[model samples]
Target chain A: MALKGNLSDFSIIQLLNLITLAKKTGALYIESSSKSARLIFREGKLVYATAGMDAMPLIKIMARSKLIPSSMAASLSERYRSLNDMELGITLINSGYLTQDQIFTGITDFFKDIIRGLFTLTDGLFHFEAEEPPPLTSIPLRMTLEDIIIEGSRQAHEHEDLKSEIPSLDVALKFAERPGVNIRDINLNAEEWRVISYVSPKNSIKQIAVVAKLNDFQIRRVVYNLLQAGLVELIRLNNPAAPAPPRMIPARNPVEQRNLVNRVIDRIKTI
Target chain B: MQTQTVKIVVTGPFNAGKTELIRSVSEIEVVNTEKKVTSESEKVKNSTTVAMDFGRITVDNDLVLFLFGTPGQKRFDFMWEILSEGMLGFIVLVDSTRPETFREARGILETFRAYAPTPYIVVANKQDLTDAWSLEDIRVALRLDSAIKLLPCTAKKKSSVKTVLLELLYAILEELDSAKS
Candidate 1:
């Protein structure tokens, strides 16, 4: 049976960590509304990855990496279009057009880029088919997943912080009423300025993101930076019903609460 | 003689040893609503808590403490909100050996925090395992606040469970003291 779950329940970082720790060989397939990706792991190490229907061919990657010339890459791709990535790589090596190290390094970087792009996907359905082999048309390289996991973890932390700071994109942004620092004194980048132009009480952060072509992370990050600089403030268009505050000890008396806690402490110490 | 009950919730992701923590410390037999693992994804354990786990400790003739463990799966998140009501404090348990659950643990922590402004501590359980992550790494993975206490714990051990409870009680005491001043 395959392991299946929503990305919201088990994030990509968690899935990678689990696979690495369990040393499971599998192919993880993830699909969102607009995109799909497949990552192949052999004995818990990443071997291959392809995003969408068409993955950038291995020869193109090698040429882009300066391992081979673009003209040679085009000719080789046309000549060996019938061959799989691994076969083409072997052909290149045997023909003295590329070395084993060059092919491996080039393909490894390409795989890393695909994985990094996958990290940005927040919502998707994923399934891992155990012992499933990589497609014969792809190159498989033995690459440890630790570095990618660490990088993904860092990004996840930053994303969480940004989400916490700006819990909703529906909230609009307005210029600070009392700007302690002059807007002119602070230097803003072109993207920041573009976002600023869209800042209004009527325009929500989500609306600005759509107009500016920024994703959730990008908009949240820009808003967070602006808020931190005291250049903007969030204005809620609709008042959200607040959750009930946590009920502390029912006893309103501080002394009673203290006594109760102390007693519990003493009892727990003995146990 | 009069007795009062103080509720402290124990919650975490599935298989994070929440039941073990309560069983190790509860004076009475724990009242658990655990069901068999029907889902293939959760086959790591034979059973999973469906509703909640209830346990108690007698703190002398006048005071008692109640420990409620919430179900670990997200489908039962409503139980977390219900179990967290009118509590003195709470404990979040994490399976130290499983980094995959760290993200789930963070989500649980955030939900509980949203429910109330109460004192809480994070317990890194299964510390006895050779592959257990260090407290610092767990701290980073969970992005826990520096002020929040992250204690090493072996939930199966009575002493370790007691220490975790004591630390939480101490935090509660400190909060009450601060409120008084």
Candidate 2:
């Protein structure tokens, strides 16, 4: 038998807490309007997680995080496309390309990413089955559900802060010119510098996220911090009266529209 | 002469072949953010694009076209808006077999028209399928205007995809020439 309920009836945090307290091992399946994912737990600890097609793969995430070159990640995916998630992780580890610590850290971040991605869902179906999930290959990842719940709450609060500062990730951003500020005085980390390199008035935060390989939340946080320090500025390009593309001819006249279609059809027949 | 780069957005509803169109036409490897389908969409395809698909192709030596494919679901419309910015033109690829998707494509087209008033064409994709609607039938079903260009294409065929691209390019070039005058 499986335990199931709407998220409205029982919040994800409370549900996970109850599972943690009871130390039940099972898999939790969550489904929303446009997204769904599964979290595999062992003795109340999350050992693995996977989501619907809207979510990128762990290999893509790793490449985005700069942990591995995108080419290497692509090759790994092509070579292990058929392997299950845990099996692929084990293969990568056995191949000596990834350390066990790296996989553990990666899996942990993946859990948080899924949690954060679906944190805003107030209504969704969840099924918790007390079945033994496939073993996580050689390295077992055991994450404290309580810690994840707490971290999720914290990030939700940060998301609220970002919501007010940045209108939308679609808004274009550009580096602000500083007349008096010394460049060397401000200590910039490599990731921050990399984010800076992609900033342009033409590139929206979403585009920057793609090039930077970071998730939207991570990129937005960087931009927020940069804005507060007067290092970047937002460009508003909302034009309500932008011209519509010129029509070939008015289609209101049925005779003219029919004639145009007929001529095109005749030309196509000849071709 | 300066290289003129045109950003064209390829969009439509679920399983409309936006990603396949870009993949078939792009010179560069398409960068896609797709994951396994786990919802009602699973009935349509195994995987769905979550973010956007990106590719590039050079046209006529001087024109470099950047192709961006929007996620099919309306939930990811924010990405569509983002991709539509400064785009020269766009193509809405509809799956002819699914009338519901044609409706979905219409909604997307309306939303995109309001966002970016660029020239667009209605691409009836998956035409190789026996059940696919004819161009005339699709036009009537979509309630498409005579002014809009409707092209039937098999998204998987590179030559067919290239033809669609060429037609869109001609439309865009016409729009650009008129804008200058």
Candidate 3:
């Protein structure tokens, strides 16, 4: 029987467990207006996964993490594009650029990032279509579902904790030094310092995401880490709903107030 | 003269038509953060507003109305408090056919009152539905104050939604007049 239902009714995590435990081969499709994702399984193990444009570039992340040189990663991507059937990891291994262990580690980190994003989706429609054998991406990484789900769950929990501390994604951020400390004295990695340079009290988290050319989740994670390290501060905008402290001087006389109300009522009558 | 922007908060229990009311009356395309309904929320609506819904209408050259629709689920209760901050007034929409949600509607009313203490009206929505409760019945079930106006409106109709806003503005004017005296 084909399995189809809302993610709310059956969580993605639980769905993954079911498919893996059953040792089934198929593709699971999940869609929401904001995002769509797919997970392919072969003999109950997750083989490939993708999520819209948010499927982050593994090479970029690897370069940022200092796992490989940016120039080398870019060159490898160009070379991989030219090949017809050669897989990226195999190509890198054959060229002696990265060892097999390094390629596998990079794959695990890349897939983990995508899985973490999928777990944040609380609402979406999902369906499982059985197949004789699942389709594979150019360089599909084979990993145990057990390990992926466990690590994804840990990342999901950490995401929730960060959200609690950084409540509104709309809140603005700015660089702030702790009391009696020199800002220049603090050590910062190239990426962390680059993100901090864009921090302005006027720039909301959403704006920061754009300026930094990173997705919302990645930018939020960076901001949360910076906050924990005492290198940044979140600026909560004054609630626009709060009643203004009684006006020092009335803006209008009673007659003016009445006239304004009348005009407003008259205009709404036409609506 | 300065153009006065008035912020009005629309709040209610799940599936009470807060989004519909704003969509009906807003002049501009509304900005809403809605996602597929998951968990227990699926028992009601197919999708739910997560963050907030925003819309705007100009009520003459000098005055503008900003409508904010708060998320319904209790998990988003913090959002209710956040959106209601600095609101000049609020509207509590109760689904006339869903009496079970009246308790939640009352709780939303109380939360807004605690935060703003401003003029408000209870909108008895879905009046077009045959199974909907009468205005008086809704008033009693919600235990509304006599001074509080109970307005029967079908949130999907533009005219009906406008009437609700007019009544709310009238109530605000009355409060201001009384305060001045």
Candidate 4:
């Protein structure tokens, strides 16, 4: 029904490559028939991605949440049809139906779930291989496994702490995903995956973070990377657990971990 | 030879001296409006540059600079690239007073940083203020890219401001020189 060379026709890796080559700084919004997808770019590096519908009706469910007027909801829904969520949020905020923070929050949640859903729908199999360097001469960006683990460990622990507060992982599982090669190549220390494994649940991110005793921001990222590589599906208990990404076993102590963050920060400062 | 004029943009966080720098250099007519913004149900984007500020300076009546200032707040950030297209380079004015702003500045910088590695200069503006930080201090605090040149300037002074702009042009010239090699 569509031309072959358009953005949707490209494979995930192809999409990533296109993004790198263009080095354009804009969000890419892609929809396939009934479904929609969004990816954000900062310069050449791929920062964020999402796929699936924004559950618009849930905003009315919050106990203390103000009841959104049917008129406003209907109007905003119309806007989403015409614009991507980022634009939609801005429009709705400008229209005074939603606050900027409110919409930003919605966008954040929407991206997370959309990303989770992205895991199940993705078809392309190519991924960053750990043992072997990415089959390219130049590195696309510095989002390597170390960054992943640092991000992942924090998330895993958050899941453990927030488990009971939110729904289970089943709802959290949305995006179609695959594992990146870095997970397999880097040897994760015991502490890292131990936290990651705990939060690999079938509900909301809260469940995994609470159960794993981890950080929310970091957990979201670990799960995000896992989903990217197709290692896990967003569907709750839809499939078996993914083999945790490789990490340097015998986890580093907290002191050592602090040093790593400092080291990375130091390197960036020098740059 | 016909003189060519190029538009150069000055942008970054609030109080990055975008307006002051423009006033110090342009031979005539510059506009600046200061407003204190309030928050609402949404994150109130405090930096209000509601419109583009224009300043003109004829360089040897050739290589003229048409300076455009953009809103520094995040909500208005979308206008950056739209304003930056086909420009020779941009001067990212840095406020040495507020270190917390460097992170926000970096975020903004990363969005537009495609090439011309030296197409920017870290003008540590407002250097003449009391208890003001030094250029190297701002440099380390901002975790600025090691590759770019850092300049200290008090945009309130014409010579100091012009010197910074000249340095930025030289940086571009140096990059162009290297590219030729």
Instruction: Evaluate fnat for each of the predicted models and list the values in order.
Output: 0.43, 0.00, 0.21, 0.00
lDDT of each: 0.85, 0.74, 0.75, 0.54
Please, what is the TM-score per model?
0.58, 0.40, 0.44, 0.42
What DockQ does predicted model 4 obtain? Answer: 0.01
lDDT of 3 by residue, A58-157 (tens): 5555565567898887886676675532365566678787777776677666666666767766568877777834343345667777886677667667
Summarize candidate 4's per-residue lDDT along A165-259 as a digit string, tens digits: 33244446443344545455755545346445654344565676667654444455566555545555555544556533322112334354333
Model 3 steric clash pairs: A241-B85, A241-B86, A241-B87, A242-B85, A242-B86
lDDT of 2 by residue, A57-105 (tens): 6677667666779889989888888886667777778988887788777
State which candidate has the highest lDDT: 1
Runs of candidate 2 exceeding 4 Å displacement: A1-271, B1-4, B60-63, B177-181
Ranking by DockQ: 1, 3, 2, 4
User: Residue A199 lDDT in model 4?
Assistant: 40
DockQ of each: 0.23, 0.03, 0.11, 0.01
DockQ of 2: 0.03
For candidate 3, the per-residue lDDT at A269 reads 88
The best candidate by TM-score is: 1
The whole-model C-alpha lDDT of candidate 3 against the native structure comes to 0.75
Ranking by lDDT: 1, 3, 2, 4
What clash count does candidate 4 reach? 65
